[model samples]
Target: MKKLSVSILYAILSVAPIAGAQGDIAAQVVPQVLSRSPEEIRPWRAPVFADQSAALGYNESAFSIPKGMEKQVQFWIDVYTKYTTEQGVIHDAENVETVYEIVDLKGLKTEREKQKKVDEVKKIIAARLSTPEEGERLRFQLGQKDRMQDAIFYSGRYLEDMEKIFRDSKVPVELTRLAFVESSFNIMARSKVGASGIWQIMPYTARPYKMISPVVDKRNHPLEATKLAAKLLRQNYSMLESWPLAVTGYNHGPTGVLKMTKSYETRELGELIQNVRSRKSFGFASRNFYASFLAALEVEKNANKYYGSVVWSKPLPAQDLKLPVSVKYKEIVSWFDGDDSKAQVYNPHLTHKARKGHPIPAQTVISVPKDKYNVALISLARKDRTVAMEDKKGR
Candidate 1:
């Protein structure tokens, strides 16, 4: 039997990992597909999970963790994250482009040419992987070790909220796994293009999901953003009808995905990825979005397999407080020991004024720490009394 190199396999699919927060090429054979006739060797049908757990199982059995598809996912995450962290706001992150270039460069038949190309690539990169150790660290960052351990930690802390939100939106709970692809559940993760929060929602997309900002961007609020993610994803699924396409649309816009799905007359995600990437409007980011998700899902599903044991983050304990009217930031913070940043953290959906300790619009829903529940309520009541007193005196 003839063996196919990992790079060759990735080339056919254009399977670079998702852009920032999502990631590229590494190896693990898809035996069933690999053994097939030349015509049969493309990404198999995208799995439609019965539930969140089953979808995760597909990620594991189908794509092994460390050496599996997740390794590629980790690759992109490390590459892109490294760029953004080091360069500080990479407007056009070149991680995806670099992967494509690497594939093409490797195709150069001569070792001397490839060496020359490697030097060229190295001089351009901020994170120097010149040493084997540096390359290993990049891979190891998300590869089934300490970094994935962090993923497992955040997963424990936030998965319940994600599942509940998805359930409420009437979408498949498994969709929660996309966070592993988007931001690695790092709530603070921000892409250069302003894809914010754990789900990496762009500002424009958030508006359609009833998320607005300059006050509060719910994207940074884990619980609220997860809910919005479910709604946005549900809308995508409703439009696309295919789970795979729906998931792909989450990374790329649904309208474009819908157009390709119709024009191509097939819903095979693998084919669509290959075809769409060739278009002038599209690129590797969208092409490999699903694969990136698959990689994260695979690693997340088989956490114990890669690491000896996982320590999960504790579930968030908080209460939703709906302000009866527009409330001053002072009033909100008064309830929580006058810490302004706490308001920002809990009420991430606030506008700039409210987020920065100014008055927020009435009827805003904010998350408050459960431990401070009574104090918050009392503070609000006190504000109401003070307002009434002032009105009485004026009368």
Candidate 2:
């Protein structure tokens, strides 16, 4: 009995110690039940307690915040300052109220400054563009009574067409009368210095617009040249953006108009006219364009009272055509000039009675009686296409 008791005691001692060791190991593996709160468990990276609690939930220890990053951390607080109701929530932080007030004041100031800039831009654009007074002055120029009877009589033909051109361009209808003072509506009108056509297009200026070709200076063709003239006027209007400058430029070229613009400084059309210093440069003709337009208006207002409407009513319409010019001048003259007459209606600049020494230039689009000669002239034009190319130097 004693031996059995001794064996049992040995087993109990050995197994009991082993069991105790296992219990000790289990106690070490179990997580510790700490008394510290979630916020207290981790150092605050953010000032907010919620952020610290999130850190604690993740079982983190001391937070590894970046050095010298206090401002960065406070920035989030500043952004969400309204949400923070706790007293002393952002001690030593930016004064959010002051910052927001300053920002609002700055926005107001910026808007005022922006409005000022917008007003300035509007003033600049207004000065550059058209104005009512300018329109009135131009009207006066068209309504002038100088060269009264003859001016109106001669201009009657082209004035009708110019009216249509100006109307299409939205330029005042009265300004069309300047064609009388410029070219007398005669397509063949040439200045002593060689400016030609109704618009008085100078050779140098007309060359660039392709108004003058080797065989033909289309500046003499009223419809063709007027189309080019309108294009040039539109371009000038874009730059100076004034009808006055545009009209002056039509007479004096763009460079001349630009000089006037610079001399005046301000782009006001009235100022430009008022400050006119030269009679030769931006002088008499340019100055008189407005006067001429005014005169034209007066004539138009009382067309029948001054000059009968018959001549004005019968003014030729502007026609646009890609004329097939192939017939030699001799052939064209034979077809158009009845009874072997040498007179050519189209190019008045051409030497009369064209002979072998002065061979008739081909492809010449003679603006004859529109309906009467169109078919016959067209058939003759197809005969000498090569001759048109041969005499390219005369023009």
Best by lDDT: 1
Alpha-carbon error at 79 in model 1, in Å?
9.1
Candidate 1 wrong stretches, greater than 4 Å: 1-17, 20-146, 276-279, 338-343, 392-395
Instruction: Give me candidate 1's TM-score against the actual structure.
Output: 0.64
Residue 268 in candidate 2, Cα distance off native in Å: 3.6
What is candidate 2's lDDT per residue for 1-395, written digit by digit as tens? 00000000001011110111111211111111111222212111111112223221122322222233233323322322222111111111111121211011123233345334433433444354366443222110011122233334445445556656655665444445556545445444555466666666678877777555444667766666666666666677666656556655766676777876786676544455545364335543454344334334444455555444323213432222234543344554454344222122234333323422344444455544444366664565554455466667556
The digit string of per-residue lDDT tens for model 1 on 157-205 reads 5677677777666666656888866765655555556677778888888
Candidate maximizing TM-score: 1
Candidates' C-alpha lDDT = 0.54, 0.41
Worst 10 residues of 2 by lDDT: 1-10
Taking all chains together, each candidate's TM-score versus the true structure is: 0.64, 0.49
Cα RMSD to the true fold for all candidates: 14.6, 44.2
